[model samples]
Target: MSREKTKGMSIIVKTITRLTVGLVLLYGIYIVLHGHVSPGGGFAGGVIITLSFVHLVLAYGKDTALKKLSKARASFLENMGAILFLSIALLGFMGGYFFSNFIPKGEPFHLFSAGIIPISNIAISLKVGAGLFSIFVALVLLKLKPTSEKKK
Candidate 1:
């Protein structure tokens, strides 16, 4: 493969993808942290974050996204995040029934408030983001064919 013309174009695309993905990640973090006090939650933030990666895959290509993140790793993260959230909820059961606020709820309108809600949001964000991102990647990869392979 010649590294001439493709270099310049790839550099530009890489820069744009990095910036967009970074912003999306930051926004997702913000939404998750403020879930207890704001309208958005883990699920919403997660979707937004995943969309960022989807954009990267679309704008740049599946190969670039896959280079940054492996399919297996992404799937593992998604499962782990779900497990973490479920474990937290199970812990609450020990207190009484379920989701019993095992942690101390600070004050309303504060970061420390909402006991386990904030944590759960973070977990869900991780699970949903990675899961959705992986799904998108799989679909894109499925459609991509080696350039060397000529059509019949």
Candidate 2:
């Protein structure tokens, strides 16, 4: 918690991480956006995004990483993601089909072509990414006390 000790890793590691984390996040978004046409989908892309933050934690330490993203925010975002995904599914009720693709599908291979699929993919990515981040935060923050300490 000391100010002096709260910094990240060595200069070299920090330099490399600073350069790479943005690219990792960008790639994750790309994967999510292109899910309908590409092999990678929401879950895979979300995991990739989560791992990038995890990489930051590994390189920088809990304090430094938590400053950028707190456990509470992660939990809130996870819930929001789930809600968004559910809402997208529920919209299908208007069309009388569960998870129906209501929006018009445009030209194939185009970024905006897949209608609800892309939206669903975004929702799933948010859910998956926030869930994984929450898990990572929990695991990193947890601490186990000795049995004797509990008795006292």
Candidate 3:
């Protein structure tokens, strides 16, 4: 059985929760796009996005979201992101010096201003998403019972 939810939720509260979560997710995407010239980056934006899932878990309960993603999958995604980030950096050394930008640098403050920065942002996003997911799975699994059938 699921744990009892405290108190009766008002319609206003439910509406606000849904609206807030939606807004946060949108803002997270914005931050991810403006990361090149702005204060925020992929990692920060990704963390912000992950909070939406946390909020969902809080409002709807962990069981619903837990079924969507498993720990092993999350861990694999995280590892892939790390590899992508490193591969981008390694590409720099392929030309001559390390950390060099092979891609062209467009106008400053523009979407393509920083070479590889956007790619890095994408990688970081993947890493953050998966890392948080892994942590959430670990936390949820700790509370679940181990089901088994053994010979007596």
CA lDDT, every prediction? Answer: 0.83, 0.89, 0.78
What would the per-residue lDDT of candidate 1 be over residues 11-61, giving only the tens digit for each residue? Answer: 767788777788887888889889989899999999998887777677666
On residues 1-152, what C-alpha lDDT tens digit does candidate 3 reach at each position?
23455433445665677789889888888888789888898888889877877776666566655565556777998999899999998999866777688788888978877888898898898799789867876786677555665433
Write down the worst ten-residue block by lDDT for model 2.
Answer: 1-10
TM-scores, one per candidate: 0.82, 0.89, 0.77
For model 2 the TM-score comes to 0.89
Higher lDDT: candidate 2 or 3?
Answer: 2
- Candidate 2 per-residue lDDT over residues 19-122, each given as its tens digit: 99999999999999999998999999999989889989988888777888888988888888899989988998887888988898999998888879998899
Question: Model 3 off-target regions past 4 Å?
Answer: 1-13, 144-152
- Sort order, lDDT high to low: 2, 1, 3
Spell out the clash pairs found in candidate 2: none
Task: Give the count of colliding residue pairs in each prediction.
Answer: 0, 0, 0
Residue pairs with backbone overlap in model 3: none
Which of 1 and 3 is ahead in TM-score?
1
